[model samples]
Each structure stands twice: as C-alpha cells, then as structure tokens.
Target chain A: MATDRIRDFIRTTRPDGPCLVVDLDVVRDNYRAFERALPDSRIFYAVKANPAPEVLKLLADMGSNFDTASVREIELAMEAGADATRISYGNTIKKERDIARAHALGVSLFAVDSHEEVEKIARAAPGARVFCRVLTSGEGAEWPLSRKFGCVPQMAVDVLVYAHQLGLTSYGVSFHVGSQMTNLDAWDAAIADSKYVFDKLARQGIVLEMVNMGGGFPTRYLKDVPSAEAYGQAIKGALIDHFGNQLPETIIEPGRGMVGNAGAIKAEVVLVSRKSDLGENRWVYLDIGKFGGLAETMDEAIRYPITTDRDADEMEPCIIAGPTCDSADVLYENTPYPLPISLTIGDEVLIGGTGAYTTTYASVAFNGFEPLRSYVI
Target chain B: MATDRIRDFIRTTRPDGPCLVVDLDVVRDNYRAFERALPDSRIFYAVKANPAPEVLKLLADMGSNFDTASVREIELAMEAGADATRISYGNTIKKERDIARAHALGVSLFAVDSHEEVEKIARAAPGARVFCRVLTSGEGAEWPLSRKFGCVPQMAVDVLVYAHQLGLTSYGVSFHVGSQMTNLDAWDAAIADSKYVFDKLARQGIVLEMVNMGGGFPTRYLKDVPSAEAYGQAIKGALIDHFGNQLPETIIEPGRGMVGNAGAIKAEVVLVSRKSDLGENRWVYLDIGKFGGLAETMDEAIRYPITTDRDADEMEPCIIAGPTCDSADVLYENTPYPLPISLTIGDEVLIGGTGAYTTTYASVAFNGFEPLRSYVI
Candidate 1:
C-alpha cells in the first residue's frame, strides 16, 4: 500500500517496454481474503472482471465458483477445471447455443430475466435449473438492464409458476442493483424483493434453495469510498436478515472488488513538450498512449496519471495526450507534474488503478499494441 | 445497401462466429473513388484503420502510400508489400527502436513533432525525410499533437534551422487538425498553417518539396455529413490556391473515411422483453453486445443497425442493449424497430457503420469473444 513499495517494484523490474506488472501474490491473497470473509456463502468469481485463465484457475484452486455470462467464458471456466455444477450462466440475453453448451457441460444454474429466455432455455436445455431476475430502481441507473431484461415482481412470479407447470425447477432468485453501486440500501431493497418472490413461489408449492446476490461491490476509485469488506459485510448481513435462517444457500459474485487494485500498467515516457498559449504547460507523451492501455479514459474527464521519475520534488501542471492522431485521445487533463523532478526525455510513468476493467476489458488496435505483457508477482 | 442484400451475405456465408467482414470490393471502390477524385494528390492509406495485410495489399497495388505510426505497423505494411520509401512514419511519439527500425527499413519520410524527436531521429535515422508538424487553430482542432509533439512556429523555424545545421533535410510541413472532422474549413485552415510553416522553413534556407495535409476527412456517419468527393475536392482546390504552380507533392491519410461503411456486425436477436413501466416498450437484446462489435459506439452516439426481419415495414420503437452485465451496456437507445421484421428470438441484425474503428479499435475482452472474423469480399 505504500508508495515506496511500488517504487521499489518499479526500480527492480525496470521493464524494457510498455507492460503490465501484476502482483500475483497480492491477487491470490486478495482472492483468498474475499473467500475467507464469506465462508458461509459460496463465491461465484465473476469472470467478466478479469477473464485470464490463470486468474480463473487461481480462484478455482481457492474453491471459488464462477459466474459466466457467455458460452465461451463457461468453456474457459470449465477448461480451468471449474466445477460445472457450480458454474452459473448469469446472462439474461441467452443464445440457443449458449444454453445448450451450458447444459451439455452439466451446468444446472441459469439466470432468466425474460419469459422469452425461459422458453428458449426450456426448448434448448430442458433440464437446466433457472432463477428469476427482479428489477429494482436506483438513480444514475441509466438504461437499466432490468428495464431491458428482468420482469416485474408479479411477472416474475408468473414466470416461476409457468416454469413449475412446464416441469422446470426454479431454485433461486437473483438481482443486480447495478455496477459500481454506492448504495447499500439498493442491495437491501433487492434482498427484500427476492424474499417476496421466495414467499410467493412457496405458496405455489415450489421451494427455492439459492439466492444469488450478483456482485457490484465497488473498488475505491477515489478516497472516501467504502472499502470492499465493508460493502461485502453490509450486503451479506442484509441477505441473512431478510431471509432469516432460510437464506437459500447464499452466493455472492464480487467482480471488481477482488481485482481492482491488485495491478498497475507500467509505461515509459516518450516525449516532453512545453506550451505557453495553453495557460503555460509542460506535456509528457508516453509510448503507452490510448492505444496501449489507456483507451478507456480517451475522452472522459481528467484521468489520474502518476510519474515514476525518481528523485523529484517540485510540481507543475501539464496535459498528457496520446500519440494517435485522434483528437479524442488524452490520458489526463491539466494534471500536476513535479517540476523539480528531473524528467529526462525517456523517464517512466506508472498508470495506477488499472487492475480490474483494463486489459481484460479493452482492446488495443490503434498502433497494433496488444494488452501489456502481464507479469504475475 | 438493400436489407435483403445484407441478409444474403450473412445467411449465405454462415461464417464461424462473430467476426469482421471486410468487403474488399467496397474498399477497392472506396479507394479508387478517392484516388479518382483527387487525381493529383498522393493517397496514403492509413493502415491503423484496418491493418489486415490484404487490405494494405489492395491499397498498395493501386499505387497508394502507407501511413504508419509505429515500428510494428510500418513493418506490417512492408510485409504486405508496401514500398519502404512510399511509407511515412507519421507518429508523434518516437521510440528509440521505432527510429532505428524506420532507418533499417529505409523509410525516409517521418513526422517530427518536437526538437527532441528531431535530435533522436537525426542520431538514429540521420538522413531520414522529416516534416516539422505545426499547430493550426481550427474549428475542430483539439487534443492537438502540437501540445504533445509539434513545435511552435518560431520553435519550428529554430528546429528547421537546427536540422539544416545538422545536415538533415527538412522535407515538408505537416499538421492534423483532428479526426472525424465535420467542418471542411478546418482543412483550409490547416493548409494555411502548413503554408506558414513552409514559408518560415523556406526563409531558414530549408526548401521543402511536399506539404503533408494530414488526414480527417469526414465519413458519412449520418446522412447530412459531407460526401468524400465534395470534401476531397475542396481540400485539393485549397492546396492549389495556397501553393499555386509551386504546390508541393501532396499526401493525405484517411482512416475511417475509407473503411467506415465497408463492413458491419451481423448479430442474432437473443432475448426480447417489454417494459411495462416505460409504457408499451419492447427490447430486443442482440447476441453480439459491446464485445461482439458494438464497441465503437461506446463513446459517440452511432447506430447503423439494419434489420433483416422480412417484415421491415412494421417498425416500432425499441431500445437495444448489449448482453454484458455492465449497466451502461446500452447499444442503441430508443431506436425504431421495424415491424414484420424477422427479429424474433433467433433472427439476425446487421449493425452497419462498423467498418472503420469498431473492428480493431474497440474493446474485445469480456465474454472470451474472438476478434471480428475478417473475410475479403
């Protein structure tokens, strides 16, 4: 957690090119720590966060289940020796082949958001287990998948009853409040909704045994954000409180929380320029531009970039843009640069907070630079 | 451009899976169209748009130059049979290896943005053909390379003088206003800036033979965007006005404008649901979400979907979202879904306007999806 430790890691490594260095020790420890925190509930490692087979293998080795949203991801988890029974295909938008593949792989658990998906699964994989997805409300919830995927609570009850009539066993209820969720009350409300569905299904003589609280526990993107442990405990406590003792063998899928801070992108500075017209500035262009690993922040607000140049003290403000011709390419806005830091032409800079949705989520095509060569600690 | 024609392509081919379908015929037509429109100017096919060797070969066969920004891309163009002398390394960020490789490959034309870059290139590729990039104020000028790479006009004069002193030939002046340019006046303004730089270099006793008017001609995103022919002619006429009979040999690099509409993503409609709260709304989720090919639309608003459902006339408004669990995964918002369209559960939807940046430039990580399968049409 100390800057000195990161500095030491960078100094000893001295990478020859643009790359990503991952502390496998930190990652494995983080995985094990999350699992230890929720010993009672099964952990479905969300593969969408970081789908590297090695990482999946690490989680599988740690006795963690996986939540796959696609057929190929399911295949990857299974190839990594994940328990087929423990694998849950949680995607609401299901292709026919996807369902058949999951069924062929003996994956019993499936997430169903629409009645159309339920019918498709029934026709394709008649014996697979299914769960009801309920829609809950929240602000900044732009384009809610609930509106696009899940049915109303009453509609979900009808789907469950219809499943029972069609000889399909409905064993669980699942709801995703949203990603980067800051409201614990949203999770609490979703848990309450799941209980209502559970009771309604029970009235129809159907007993549910699983309640999947889909993961969205935020990683502290900035200071003052709640820690993952605090987020996890709050949700877990709500699940227990809502369902009392019959919480249906709870399962939590924490994607970003487990891997968001365990890695960093290491890039070398390519150029440094000074501009007087743009409010007096110094600019450092790195070889690791929007093409390499910073593509996500290409046009958003100011991105946070830190210099790895050693023995620096005085600071100045400068803009960091990528090498691509696209005007949209920028790494950060008028960002601070340590002025006294003797930034030679070819110094190094480490782009931090890139562990979760970076290499595993984005592509590098601008300069034909693939994701950085990842090194496990 | 008929709906039936697109459907024929998808149904007849039944390719392996979701992949890039590059219509070589369409690309060749685009290439020849641009060449014929600006018969006098040089056309440098920006390989960053579609680095597939065949595409490069098609352009190279037609007597076009290659615009590369990295050592890897330059080498790829060469491997694809591009003449070393005809390739211009227009990258602003110069790595040590990049300069060395350009020198080794005998690619003389280069874009120099900084005095340090000039020094590095002079040391590495001593006799390389260099162009001093200048900043131009225009309507769409943003994320200016001048901020990261270009020298000021005065500094450019100094750099040109210094390069002459170092026995390095300053071949020309180059400037990129921006990408996806809608304002054609930006091209005129850039040419004016190029003339100023050329004149200043001439005063410094650095005679130039070429004026590289950097790329960013508009491609048709919406119907109202200017046609390539109109924009190309406007630029050509402006170059003639600025340089008159002594007009230097010209070079133009077009990435998206060349391949933007040459291909599309054909995805199947997987799940359909209705939003009761949002009124009588129906949502059709595609098998190919953001990962499949909708990655380019993640930033700007772009929707070029063509429904193959036979009942196209019965169109209605529907929101389409990708299959990813991320809440921000809406592919198209409030788009009209034609009725009588065959977009039932398993029908296919061809997403157009994806030929340029969507294939290689977008995110391809989650779902373990393969890159767009490319086929020469």
Candidate 2:
C-alpha cells in the first residue's frame, strides 16, 4: 500500500515519467518492528535492497549493521555512517581484489560457500571471519533460489575447515531459506543444518560462534503475508529446538522485508486494448515494465498489486505489459491481472510493494527510456 | 568470433572490469551484407539493440534509417545525423505526450497494433504514417517473442481502417518473426499476412505502401547460424511468393543481426569450484552476470559462445554464473557449458556474439556494480 505521505507526495508533485517514491517513515517503522521482533539477533539490513543514501543513513542512525555484496556497497554503507565493524561482505562469490579492498576498508567478516572462495579470502583478507553458507531446498519460496548459491552442509563443513586451516576465523555458518519465503517452518531444517555444522566444527576444535540467518522474509504484495514478529518468533523457536540452551550469535539480513512495502511506483497507462476484436483479455500497457524496474515479474514470480484511479469501476482480467519494444516486457500475461475495465490511456496506476529490488534492476536506458527514477522522502 | 579490432582493443587496453568492445568495421560489413541481401528493402537499424552514439553515427553515415522505440531514440538518431524523415517510431505502445513530442521533433512515421494506439497517434501526431503490426507465431526463434506485441491479421485490418478513419495514414503492416530467429521460411507466413492486410486496405481505397518486417535475425553463438546473404535470399523469395510482381516498399528492422556479432565482452573468472566433494559440475562465476548485462540468458534463451585463453587445455562442462549475490545471476546451468578444465579464478574469458542487447540490458547499479561499460572501436 502507498503510505498516506507517499500518496500525498504523488498527488501534489506529480513527478514526470515512471518514478518510485519511498516513505522513510515506513522504513523507520519496519526497522523498529524487526528490531523488536528479533531483539536477541543483530539486524544486518541488506544494502542491495534499496541502497538509497537516505534509507541507509536512517538505518545506520538507528544502529543497524549492513550486509553488503560488494566493495562499492561497503563504501555506500560507510558513507551513510556505518563503521567497518558493522558491515559484512556477504556475497559468497567475489573477486580476490574486491576481498582485499574490503579488508583494507576494515570489513573483517566475509561469506564463503566453496573452497575456491575461501582460498581467495584466505589470501586477500587473511584472518578475516568467514561463514560457510549451507544449501536449502527453497521449497516454499515465491522466488526459489536454486542450486546457484550455497553448498550442501557436508561441503560447508569442509569449506569451514579449510578456512580454519588457512588461519581465518571459521566464525559462523549461513543459509538463505530463499527470497520471499512464505512458510514459517522453512527455517527449521536450515537451523538444524547450522547446528550440525556447529557440532562438527566444535569436534574439530574450530568452534563456530555465529549463525548468519540470511534474508528471505516476505513482504506483502497481492497476498497477505505474516508479520516480522511471526517470522522472528518462528526462527527463535527453531534455533532453540535445534541448539537447546546456548544460542550462537545470530544475524538476520532482511532485504525485501525491510523495504519492499515502503515504496510505491507511480506509472501511467500508455495503452489499453485487446489483441483482437474477440480477444478475451484486454492488454494494458504501463509506462513501467520488466526493464523499467519490475524485473521480479519475470516468470510472474512477484505479483505486484496495481491500483488505478478507476478501481471503483467494474473490473476485468487484463494482460499487463511495459511500454517497450521487447515482447518479453509483458508483466502479467500467463495469469492476467485483474484491473478496472474503465482504465484507459493516461490513467495513473500505483504499483505497490516495489520499494526493494526495483530501481537497481532497472536497465540503464533500454529502448531509450531512462532508469526508474527514485525519490526518498 | 571477436572481430580482429575488438580483440586487439581488449588485448592492448586490458580494461579492469567487464566491458563490451564493439568493432565498427564489423558493423559496417554487416550493413553492407544486409543491403546486398535484399536490394529492394530499406534497412532500419533497430537502435534499441545498440544505441551507442558511434554505432548510430556509423549506421547513419551509411544511409541507414533508424527504428526508434522512444522519443529519446529519435533524438539519438537525429544527433547521429539521421533526419527525422529517416526514423520510425517503431514501438506500438506509446504515451500520447510522447507521440506529440515525437511529432514536434519532426517524426512522421509511427507503429500501431490496436485502435486505441491508433487513436492516440491520430490525436497526438495528426496525419502520421502508421503501420499496423500483424501477429506472428514467433516459431523457430531461439528467443520467442510470444503474444505480447502484435494483433491478429483480421484485427490488424480493422486497426488500419480505424487509423484511416481517424485521419491517419494507414501506411503498411509490420510483424516480428521473433528475436534470434533461425528458420529461413519464418518470414513467409508473416509476409503473406502483410499482403492480406495490404489487399484488404486497398479494397477500401486506403492504399498501403510498405511492409515493415521487424527484426529477428540470428547471430552465431555456439552453433553456426545461416549467413545474412542466405537470410536475405530466403526473405526475398518469401516476399516474391506472397506479393507476386507488384511488391510494395519494404523495411527490414535488423537489431541483433546488425550488431550481435560485432562485439565481444571481456570478463574475468572470479571463482571456480564444485558444490561438494562428490559434485559432478564445477560452478564457474564470472565478473559479470544477468544483471550486469547478458539478461538474454534468462531461461538460457540466448547462449553466447565463451572462449578462454586456455581453450587448448582439456575441456569439461561447468555451470556458469555471475558474481552477483542473487541466485538468478546463473547464466548456464540446465545445459552446462563446456569450458577449459584448467580455467580458474583470474582467468580471462571473452563472451562472443554479445555486441547487441548487452550494455542496454545492464542494471544501473545492481549489487553496487557499474553498468556494462561499452567501447566502440
């Protein structure tokens, strides 16, 4: 939903072209909610989610740590008032020079899922704290991250062992249940895997000190989603069920959940028509589409709730697409989107739950259209 | 293959990050080949494929008309020395204001697929030359365009009639066989459909003049594609078969065909490792991925041939991915790519057939990485 402030801003300013307006108050509230829900766990706001300087500064001022994927993100976080100690170089796949750059910037924590990555970290950032990411089934994720990222628990054990031998601190283990995960129980198995690594590493006299529970928290889109409290309580119960009394230092990286709902995209309907006279569905073209920022629409994985000024009118299913020359720019075609039948050209539409993973996914200038403009309030 | 010029540029400059190098000589040769292929047809270089200023300038200097998607593209073409009369606003979807802007900028040709779009063009750019896009099955395409673009032939006739009623010039019919199309006979049915539209319009005394055959030309990847001359011969035969002796003016919008083989991307291997001790495939992470550019890798639809310095070494299949934290960054996994067994971190890999659709698809700043840098030699 577009916050009252965001709605007023759009109504008054009427920024030209497709633009995203993020309400900082909502981001502040989300940060507070996450902090309260996981009081025992440190919050590492995933910097890649928004990376807006204002959002970062707000979170940093509120004492939030950051999980960055690259040296540039580290610089952004630092620029927003975060210390190196509060930042983690969280991508498992990294170049050796980047690792060295992060190390020089005083970022001591790093993520590694393979021996090769560990070798690079060992050489570039000797003695840095390293975490091995264990693989998850990603069964209940709306956006299931397949086998591209983490390794199996057995391999993670080997990787951590290798890190320990290289004089690096085998400080922890990490696993992402997957992005936009819905099932609350998704963390149970992953927590169990973390425990297994912890026990195995302890036996080898290389005790793991933390479990970085990577982000997968869901944000409300077209469907209702559980609150941060629900996720935190579920994750805490799982950690207790698996590790008993002594819980390792926990870190939760919340990207989508932190900012997805804080932003709303204001776009205009460019065209509305059926493919043929007898066509069943109306094809609605918006100024923004896949290349414009809503790339999560790929495979129709993330269904954004679209609201138009004519929503009070009778509704019909429509094939939604972007205003680009590419055929792949269609957003909701397989499962047509339910939009107001009265919607026509020049009508304004608000796409909700686009605060995260939007501006960055936008192309630089595909079809000569500029990148999705963003305004942080 | 990376052209001699591109290879020499990369070898001499040794750009620090992943970058695309395009050879103007290759582009010039491609333009000549297309002209030779269909002597009767006019070449409309699809600017969306590669809007590099140097590229546009080169095509403009060679008397190539431009197929533009937005007003910015029109301005780009004009800046490259293409007169407004030589550019076509080729995207069927458009904003009314944008149509007005294009008209004010002296653009007179427009594309429309539905009555609603025709109405906008008529109201915004009165008496503009409009072409109705007829639907194609998009079969025999490596990257199928699906039903997001055109209208059915019967509906196209209605659309053109409606355009004529609205005081717009119903100039012709257009269709895209699909991107990276390989089937030589793919243009036959589409051309036949155009003839049907032309005949229907002529019966009503609204004489259509041209047939805009939208781009779908293939580029050589791992497998060899038919030559431009071969495609030209096939298309010409299809046109003659459908139109008989009195053929209308024809426009060929060749995006990928004109530029895909003219450029190459130079990237470094960031990491190479197997997931587990018993893992069968090595995961090769490069400095660039889908978001950085090469978004055509979505669904592994377009596979660019990858070459390494150690190609003479033993070869094995590997799962290729980008260096981003996102799992969707994996380029090739379902069908593993065969690469040199000796390939490891720090090794340079050149991705060929990437001249088109690379720099433009790159994210503005996903994961804090810069967009794919382009160097036009």
DockQ of each: 0.48, 0.89
Positional deviation of residue B88's Cα in model 1 after best superposition, in angstroms:
0.6
Best-fitting candidate, measured by DockQ?
2
Off by over 4 Å in 1: A1-15, A136-152, A221-224, A275-279, A295-312, A334-341, B2-9, B136-159, B221-225, B275-280, B334-342, B362-364
Best by TM-score: 2
**Tens digit of per-residue lDDT, candidate 1, span B149-180:** 46566666666666767768888887766666
Off by over 4 Å in 2: none
What TM-score would every model get versus the actual structure? Answer: 0.90, 0.99
Model 1: how far residue B44 lies from native, Å:
0.5
lDDT of 2 by residue, B1-377 (tens): 99778888998998999999999999999999999988999999999999999999999999999999999999999999999999999999999999999999999999998889998898999999999998899889999997988899999999999999999999999999999999988999999999999998889999999999989988888888999899989988988899999898999999999999999999999989887888589999999999998999999998899999899999999999998889889999999999999998899999999999999999999999999999999
